[model samples]
Target: MRAVIQRVSHASVTVDNEITGSIGAGLVVLIGIHEDDDEEDAAYIVGKTTNLRIFSDDDGKFDLSALDTSAELLVISQFTLYGDTRRGRRPSFSHAMPPEPASDLFNRTLRLFEQTGLKVQTGRFQTHMEVSIHNDGPVTILIDSADRHRTRRG
Candidate 1:
């Protein structure tokens, strides 16, 4: 599983002109499930997303985790994260997990986020939706379950 986590002042997802999910002062998480991903991968991502210290402290240092700030989360299923464009103009999604199992993992991941006690919102899966994000600090972090060390703070 891979996730693009962006700190946001606010974010929302709309489908068919209807708002499906929205959040304030939090992170917008775009998650992609790999073909080999499972519950463990989902768990790893959930832990990192909630605990990563991307927020700033009073001294303007990156020392506050989302959990510390009680930040909300906007989770979205983003299979396109796995798009392989090495070959040609067209991006191949062969590395992305199939929709059926992928959706299951996505839902499970969302549930894990919700279990964190912080407010959690989500985009509609497999739907044509528009997302609005107001990025905070323009801080963005990429996380991959396969690359555990990359997400760790020294």
Candidate 2:
């Protein structure tokens, strides 16, 4: 599982002119499930999304988290996050999970997110949609489940 988390002032997802989900003062999470991802991957993402100290505190430091500020979430399924373009100009999605199982995993991940008691919203899965994002501080973070065990180097 991979997640691109964006701190946003507001965000919305529209499907065929209808607004499916929206959020304010929170994060927009573009999530992707890899072929080998499993339940632990989902859990890892949910944990990070809720706990990452990306939001500012009263003194203007990066000290607050979604849980601390009661931030809303706009979760969007985005398989393209796994696009592999190392070989050619065209990207390959062979690393992305299949739709059927991926959808199941996506829903399960949503359930896990909801358990945090935050306002959770979602875009229609497996559909063409438009996402409007008002990035706050233009803050973005990338998380990959496979890197959970790797130590960061300075």
Top-lDDT candidate index: 2
Most TM-score-accurate candidate: 2
For model 1, the stretches where C-alpha displacement exceeds 4 angstroms are 149-154
Give model 2's TM-score versus the native structure.
0.98
Worst 10 residues of 1 by lDDT: 145-154
* Candidate 2 structure lDDT: 0.97
Give TM-scores for every candidate, taking all chains together and pairing residue i with residue i.
0.95, 0.98
What lDDT tens digits, residue by residue, belong to model 2 across residues 1-154? 9999999999999999999999989999999999999999999999998999999998999999999999999999999999999998999999999999999999999999999999999999999999999999999999999898899899
All-Cα superposition RMSD per candidate: 2.1, 0.7
Backbone atom clashes (below 3 Å) for every candidate: 0, 0
> Candidate 2 has which clashing residue pairs, if any?
none
